[model samples]
Target chain A: MLSVMETSRTHDDREREAALQQLQDIERAQAATWLDHPATPWWWAPYFAVWSGALVLSVGYLPGWGSALGNLALVAASGFLIGYHRRHRGTWPTGDIPRELHRPLWMLLVGAGVVMAAATAIGFLVSVWVSAVVTDVLAGLLVWRYERDYARAAERARRRLP
Target chain B: MSAPPEAGHEAAPAPLADLDPVLTAPKRLAFMAVLASSASTDFSFLRRHLGVSDSDLSKQASALESAGYLTVTKDGRGRGGTTTFKITKEGRRAFERHRDTLRALLG
Candidate 1:
């Protein structure tokens, strides 16, 4: 002869207890997969620095006859390193090499490089300057947008947990 | 003449024994999954990834935090409000035990 309120209260308590227990079980399963590797923040620091330096050099050096060839070389080197990293990690999405290479940011950068090279070949330093300015603005915007998206994704992950 | 004795009927099986009660809830499982994948994550990150409201996350996080399974810390300036979380040693051990128990039960 229990009252309805008492019965509901008992049910709620049991539910929370059960949920907590399940949480523990999941944590254990995940630990088996997660704890093997020690955290390393600097694992890819050298690679990132090298790539960043090359990008800065390619962008900062202005439009000139020789600069186009140098820029092309930079692009080739960057592409090779990116491909090598992806292959070594075995993390490449399933697709042909060309299709797998389709990163929007990378493509935009390459396009800018090509335009700068064209302006240099035609002896239009002014055009090259304009292109550089446009590319810089676009790159900044893209970076800001990506950071926002990453933050949002991280927040969503947190909310999924009890 | 009287009828012959009737055969016995077996009772129905329980629903998968409540799925270990501790490992069956969705949000808790998701939390464990995220923690298992990342070295450490923060409260904001988890909340955004899980798509739960702030209050809801706080409540669930408190339960795990109290159980010694997670460590939570508040940092950053007043406006920024950053809180970080990491799994503790006891938390890892508990998780391992739970996994073994589930495997045994399933078998």
Candidate 2:
């Protein structure tokens, strides 16, 4: 690496300015790489689409207990697989984000929970297809919406910091 | 001495005194930047990303580790082993301060 920033205390304004400029360039390059880098691979998108679709389809086509069992199996299997994969990989990311950025995500979870609760309540009083529309289509849309909105909010908050 | 100005990390140019020399080095700074973004990063990832030699990366990592800025862990045995690096809380704080200080200077 360049020792361009290793100037001494005797350095003048011009040299200091150059170092600062270089630092800015470095920061910009790093930021670009950081933002563009995906935590998951491209295949993850299709995985999500297929899995969610299957969950929704199951809720609509299967008997109530069958749907419940399928959903339960999916959740349990997903949890187990993720844990197993990470454990074996050893270098899997901890996926930590600052607690402040988590505020909106937590709220989003609460909102999703409320929607899910409403869907289950509706299921008790209505047909599986009706509940599936709420739980599947609307809930999926809500997640996507919150993901975009909350991510923007988090970026804003980070920028606003001193 | 007069007290330092209190507000605006963006508008006011920060003094060089505020910058941590530990993270000011190019390689170490880059390593810390990556660490700050990720939960943990492998030594190889950092090496490949920075395009630095193993010894060169090791020297910088050693400095940062000694300074309590990053932790270096050996994940396995012998040649099969992988080295992992994670930033300490203090290291993260210093990295953030260094970034803000640089930005302030840029302005």
Candidate 3:
């Protein structure tokens, strides 16, 4: 009897079909829930906006000490974000680390810093403010790029859903 | 992953034998679905995510363990230890086969 039952559905094919559909519905809902909930609860947009705004505003109008303090704070925040991400990388259901994520953004920041440092050491060569403007522009571009990259990754993940 | 059923399964409903009983239960299936997608997950998080009571979750989880579908590790010592559950290779294969067979049945 068990073998026969295993080989075929019970006589009520309609009822069996209904049960199958309900199971599929439940399964899909479960998949969708897990899909949306990544291990790392990344809330990037607002944090990026607030910090970047403060960074640029401080560089533009804050007193020298105030600007320096603001920059220091921003650097600390960046460090904290990296640390938090690393903490979750291996331990949680976040899966593999996206090795390519924000690569361009990090490189841009590094390149901008290197160029700015060289410009300042040359003794009033082009203009002091020019270097700051260039770096600030690069940072703004990074903010934009990060958002775009995150969106792309999210869409790619959605395709794997049930 | 186990090879999906050959083309004939599309016309006839997949045999019940094609399904993995351990993966068929709603809660257990949900558990495997979550674990299959990750390296590991905290016990508490998985239970909450499955929306099952603690004892119920523990029972289903233990059944999976006994079936060689998953492994449960109790972190630290005995009581009050944090538990972490990870799906084994067999579990991953079983889940993929079950999922594919399920799709075939639905068709």
The number of the candidate with the highest DockQ is 2
TM-scores, all models, native as reference? 0.37, 0.54, 0.51
Q: TM-score of each model's B chain?
A: 0.67, 0.85, 0.83
Q: Is candidate 1 or candidate 3 better by lDDT?
A: 3
Model 1: per-residue lDDT, tens digit, B1-107? 97654343223223345343443556655665556545566665566556798888887778777777788778666866666666777766665565554444333
lDDT per residue as tens, model 3, A1-162: 666664655553664674476466445434432344444454554565456556655665579999899889889998998666433442344333333334544665675565446545431565445544554454455556655665566455456433
Give the fraction of true interface contacts kept by model 3: 0.23
User: What is the CAPRI rating of model 1's predicted complex?
Assistant: incorrect
Worst 10 residues of 1 chain A by lDDT: A92-101
Q: In model 3, which runs have C-alpha deviations exceeding 4 angstroms?
A: A1-91, A94-162, B1-11, B77-80
Candidate 1 per-residue C-alpha lDDT over A1-162 given as tens digits, one digit per residue, 9 for 90 to 100: 348657755765564565556545454334322222222223243444344444444555645755677678878877877665433322222211222123543654665565446434433444444444444444444444433443344344334422
Using lDDT, rank the candidates from best to worst.
2, 3, 1
Per-residue alpha-carbon lDDT of model 2 for A46-134, expressed as tens digits? 44434554565576667889989989977986797676444333334343444444666787788767766766677778865677566
DockQ for every prediction shown: 0.08, 0.19, 0.18
Per-model C-alpha lDDT, please?
0.51, 0.65, 0.63
lDDT of 2 by residue, B1-107 (tens): 97675442222346778888887677778778777766666766677667799999999999999999998878688877879888899998998888777776655
Q: Return the top candidate by TM-score.
A: 2
DockQ of candidate 3? Answer: 0.18
